[model samples]
Target: MDRKLNRELVKATALRSGYSFTKLAQEVSVSTESVSKWMSGETNPRPGKAIKLGKVLGLSYEQMFGVRDRTLEPQVAFRLVRNQDPSEEHHERAREMGRMYEDLVPFLPFNQFEAPPRLKSPTADYEYLDELCGSLRREMGLEADVPVSLPSIFNHLSDKLQAVVIPVFWGHRKNKAELAAHIYSRKTKTTWIPFNLDTKLWDARFWAAHELAHVYTFDVLDDEAGEIFSDAFAGTLVFPVPIARAAYEELAKVRLKTQKFNLIVEFAKRMHVSPICVAKQVDRYAVAKKQPPVNAEYDGIYAAISRMSKREKTVAEEFFGGEEPSVGQLLEAAANIFKSPFFDTLSKYLKTNGGSPSFIQGLLDCSLVDAKALNSELA
Candidate 1:
């Protein structure tokens, strides 16, 4: 075998198996230096060691020997659009989630799964998008001007589009850039939207709609303009133009800043959107109608909403009648794919050969505890 191909195979297997060179060496009973040489093209594993390597990494001898099969790779290709530049760790985490979803497909109890046909144009303007949203609402059996039921919309998208809507719980409160991400696999025609859960129901709902917009316009929009269009689309989908016009008319009559702030809150609650969204949409509507924007007094409105004595239930809880689903639960479900023969073989090999929990954690981008829990589940 060509040393270059050997190096590529080693590197690719390590990534797919979630093992570092040292860890790979430990699993295969080879020295770290030997594994490094194999990966660097300075040496190749002996036949006996190569077989062990394949077993531990869940690859066939042909795969390790460079007889590559395209089918063995992730069947789905994903495009990720984040609000800001993500850290390397964040990227790895997202990629791990994608891989898990791909592995779960064959095990999921469903058939004839396919993503909805892309219905958006890259060159679509606001008018085109407006008509698109209205049409989509009608297709989904929703009224043109009614406030969208966020949970109902989620369930509908999940079923109709064959997409997974997973809520990601980021424990850090200050990380604002990592809002939501949309990942799609062209090969499998699958889409997954992992949204941030550490936000108000209204904000999370907007983010969900924003990601849905990305799914519709994935190939068309790749820059700042695409982002702007997605935001507009999300706002429109949540609060349609007719509803926005009526809210604008009513909000325009208020003169006092405090009064306006209160009114904006009420409008947001009624429409199931954030007050900030209502304020911005009201401004957009005013510009369209050639009227002055409402005096929303943004800061005061946020402060007042925050200072409210009664806490409203989140949209997820309200709709589902319980706590929002957690990322751990999703991962747990994905881990069931291990019951398949390939993953079962890997699990048996690890158990018999004393595989480290870190190997599973690294491969799945999960916690040590989670890795252990998954191992027990697989057992």
Candidate 2:
């Protein structure tokens, strides 16, 4: 279905929230003309801005579009690609999955975990975040210059923060939203994060790090600054400033663009992260050090990383084969590889409460047939 902004709903909600068009635009960092256009249905804001606008007007994305999912608890944080927003069907499916997780949390062994300390007075300052990440690296017993082990990172989230990190096969499509649903269930007082496992290993590592940052700083983050902090935190956590400085020193010696590209690719390969992560961290290091930023074509660097990632198998592919995996196999991958107890706990709950396979289908984004197999396996 062709979806457009619900102009009447936007206008009504904004008015109820005590916002004039100019005030609404100012609140969301858009112009009065743009707000008028959105209200007139002449244009629609990008997904990020639309969500921002909804937040300012006290509406959800679905509410602004006249199709609210009342079952979905308010989201603490979520990340989407710049150009692609989840379609309504995809959005609702994700929300339903999140609700299922929430329903099972009461039966899960959630109390064994503790929440991480929140950042006080969060800022997007490079040096401040760099230092914060440095402290976190040391606290986590990670060597500053070494590549962070992916399993170690996953275990940290599970053991330290009490977060349920569910890895689902979201498909290998361009412009797909990475973190579809990251909700903080008030009833359970737990955070449920489901990220795409379809991304390559390196990219998946970065995304996992990104979720870690979000869990760390959720209490202090807004939509915009939260993303900035999460990006910086993820980059610095995986490729810290010490490593960035070393890479920068090598990059400074190179004059050719190809040389700079090669140096970045090499650094990324060494760190086992995306070249984009490497490049951004290098830029942050340069800014903090008060030095001229290295010159590199970011698009070329990103394209190269994409090509390299294509060769590396995604988390799903690594665990299950290329064909569709049975629910039992998927759960095994989640439990073993992700180090997540979500399915194990849910299986216990299902045994007592007697739930349906459709819930499993929604949670794993798998077919009903696969979900039925999970019920049978549980039986």
Best by lDDT: 2
Query: What lDDT is reached at residue 284 by model 1?
Result: 72
lDDT per model, in order? 0.61, 0.73
Put down candidate 1 lDDT per residue, 159-278, tens digits, no spaces.
555556654444333443455666665545566665544445767667767777776766566656567777888887887777778888888788887778777778788878887778
Clashes of each: 1, 0
- Per-residue CA lDDT of candidate 2, range 82-197, in tens? 43555644554455455567767766665635555667877768778778877877877888888877677778788778888777655654434564357666545677787777
For each candidate, give its TM-score against the true structure: 0.62, 0.75
**CA deviation > 4 Å runs, candidate 2:** 1-72, 81-83, 86-91, 112-116, 172-180, 297-299, 320-328
Task: Give me the displacement of residue 167 in model 1, in angstroms.
Answer: 3.2
